[model samples]
Target: MRLRRARTIAAWALLIGSIIGWPVAAFGPARHEPQFVLGLSFLALIVESASLLTASQVHEETGSK
Candidate 1:
């Protein structure tokens, strides 16, 4: 249960981080390459997937009869 909660929090943080950071890292005043944006997006997807999986586990464990 704790693990699920921790993972869920981490996933939310990562999701928000990627959302805010992507624009800055990829297309900010520094002007990064397209590959950088793509990579960040890919990483975000991975984090999201993990978050969803953990959340599913938590739901299953505590689900109604």
Candidate 2:
């Protein structure tokens, strides 16, 4: 239960971070630096992958199917 809850929270944080980070990196002040944008995008991708993994685990535990 605790592990699931922790994963859920981490997944949520990563998902939200990616959602907010992408725009900021693309259009915000950091846009001036190509490296920053690329780095942020990469980070967002990693976060998204992690979130997906956690979400899948949660779904499995819940026996959704």
Each prediction's TM-score against the native?
0.51, 0.54
- After best superposition, candidate 1 residue 15: deviation in angstroms? 0.5
RMSD of each: 4.2, 4.2
In order, the Cα lDDT scores of the candidates are: 0.66, 0.70
In model 2, what is the error at residue 33, expressed in angstroms? 2.6
Question: How many clashes in each structure?
Answer: 0, 0
Model 2 C-alpha lDDT versus the unseen true structure: 0.70
Tens digits of per-residue lDDT, candidate 2, 1-65, equal 66666666667676777767777767787777787657867686866768676776766589644
For residue 3, model 2's alpha carbon misses the true position, in angstroms, by: 2.1
lDDT string for model 1 (9-55, tens) is 77666667766675566666546566666776758676776677578
Q: After superposition, how far is residue 53 of candidate 1 from its true place, in Å?
A: 7.2
Error of 2 at 46 (Å): 5.9
Best by lDDT: 2
